[model samples]
Target: MAVLAVVSVAGLIVDDRVLVGAPIWAKSLKFSVSFVAYCLTLAWMLQFLTRRRKLGWWAGTVVAVTGAIEMVIITGQVIRGRRSHFNHQTPFDSALYNVMAGTVAVLWLATLILAVLLFRSTIADRASARAVRIGAVLGLAGAGLGFLMTQPTPGQMRGTSDIVGAHSVGVPDGGPSMPLTGWSTTGGDLRIPHFVGMHALQLIPLALMGLVALGARVPRLRDERIRAHLVAVAGAVYAAVLALLTWQALRGQPLVHPDGATLAAAALIAAGAALGSIAALRRPVGGNRAGTPERTRQPVG
Candidate 1:
């Protein structure tokens, strides 16, 4: 994580010249910084998920190495004024791109495996466990969306085989985009849901932590049963929102230019979240234990 942070800072300090498509350094810089935080957070969670110390170490090592390689390739391409993703212009570039794809595949598999292990095992903190489980599921779904970006859109391959499809739906790749992130403002950008889904690992856990803090201050909020229900409801709502964004993008609608359908979907998601929260407050949180009832455990440390 420290190494990635240094790379991120260097990327920011470098010249902001456009490379093959966009401001190359900015993309690398942003991803590097965000990924650094992501890696550390995942590592922290993995510790609580498994009792096998060596297995945890190995998993973390693989993630660190693959992530660093990914960052290196992206930054390296930026320095060469070339596109790192979907660049099949030359044999060398294609090989580099293929390597990155493999690295990400491995990382994804490892993460999914860890998530499975987490789900099968019992953790001390129900709230945190639920958060991790939900986060992993959403994160994988988001990563799966990357496959859509790789396929060539109809008519996109007619002009140039060097480029396949794009993250944008109606807009061409490298066309008019949102500031900094470069998501299409005129059309659906698949990256929107992809980005949103990937961060569930962090967001869901953070939400649970916030609840824990609130419980610390408010006497009524101190019940673990209620906290567990709240966390579960929050996860459900988060997943629903993620699904809504994906649906919006698939319908070829830009996030900023939501149509009536998008508005309606958003409203439905909000209402569902609100109702779920209400139900959580009214129900016994720890009563359900994989269909078997267990006495409420002590509050998690």
Candidate 2:
């Protein structure tokens, strides 16, 4: 993770621009490289945790698949420049990028489906399961809405200053037009929905963790005794913060503006540590046999 972070920072320094002016190939390459590096780091961390706990393999698999799709998309973008076959560009690059994007979208849908399945299994209890299911449904719906927002509106194609931005690269004169709004063109293209949708992947999982943690506190749930209450609560708080950020994005708020996402994330991290300490104190101290009931011998009497 540290290595990826360093690489991403280095890429940002080298690019020295946001989403514009850089050659199409260079821009795509940089973005994809940074994104893939980050995703892989996250996947590794999640895998490590899952291995230790022996839980949530399915969730880990979803994360791994998501990372793989991200890599493939980045590869296609880096190789293909900005043009695709359907957009009237050269067939090879265009076809590959288009196919890659389509495949990614499909995989994203599958990820959502798998999340629902995992939620069901993890929650187990009826009420907790229902809460998780609702959160998953909201996340999927939000993603669909965001996808629609990525398409070019009819009026947007004709002319609009809103499409222009500080970092936009205009299409080469007479070059093949991009069918999508932000990718093929330049300007103030609203990508808020896309941002929201992508973060949903994180938000949904965190929400599930929260639900599970809360369920553990319930008197009736068997899994309530499971360690990790703090982890679950911390996850829930983090998810809530992400959801707020998503709401801000959906409202077209600027990313850098103070919306409290950072503070919230920090708080959650601190709380997680505290909760973890508390949970550790409550854990069973000895081997399984020590906690099991001792049977008395009857034959001697």
Candidate 3:
């Protein structure tokens, strides 16, 4: 995937061809970069598993293999100067797209398997364990959001054989999109929320680590119970944001251009999340006695 990133950059520089109004190599680069992150995250996460090490290892490979296959088709389509997704102009294109869809579905299932295993695993840190579990579930939801784009749209239902589905709603694909991400700027784009949700697996856990590092100076944050409580609050906020983005896109609202109702709902979610965080942080460090540090638990595995 790293090599693909470099090659994709070169292609973007040398190849002037445009597909779907974006640079030909842009999609390939995006997928390559995403897959790199996805695989590395799973690799890091699988280490926490105890008795299911063999199954976890195998499922991890499934994710990597399926991801690589999808990337191959995406890059191959780019090389052929064709749109990869929802493009059914040719029989070959349709088949390749179907293959991509199948591989993604399989990868999603593999992730689900890993999530189940994670529940039974022994993670040493109280805060880290809770963050990982919450992150996995939320990330799964985000990854599943991609399927919403695969269904035939109203226009497609009215009668188009050249395409099956689209990523944009209230407008067709290849229209005005956000820079780099290609999220529809003129209409609701599912890709924005999908991207946001999928990365929470890394983001939430990374935030927990950041708090751990900050705990050295902020003595109140050093309590294990406080850290765990904070993680719960952060997880709740992450889930709420994911829900909001999904709702926004389904209503055909762009991420940046939320209407009054959308804005109101967002404000409500924000206010609630803020309150939750404040409450979590303000709790008395009661779990440990005065002047005694909380003992870290050894890995149960």
Check candidate 3 and list the clashing pairs. none
Better of 1 and 3 by TM-score: 3
Worst 10 residues of 2 by lDDT: 164-173
Q: Candidate 2: which stretches are off by over 4 Å?
A: 1-6, 15-63, 75-88, 122-135, 155-190, 200-301
- Residue 241 error, candidate 2, Å: 12
RMSD of each: 3.1, 11.8, 2.2
Candidate 2, 212: how far from true, in Å?
11
Candidate whose lDDT is highest: 3
Q: What local distance difference test score does each model get?
A: 0.77, 0.43, 0.87
Q: Judge candidate 1 at residue 154 and give its lDDT.
A: 73
Deviation of model 2 at 253, angstroms: 9.2
Best by TM-score: 3
98-147: candidate 1 lDDT, tens digit per residue: 99989988888877777777787677767667887888888888877877
Q: List runs of model 3 lying over 4 Å from the truth.
A: 286-301
Per lDDT, what order, best first? 3, 1, 2
Q: Report the error of model 2 at residue 225, Å.
A: 16
In candidate 1, which residue ranges exceed 4 Å CA deviation?
1-14, 51-53, 284-301
lDDT, model 3, position 158:
91
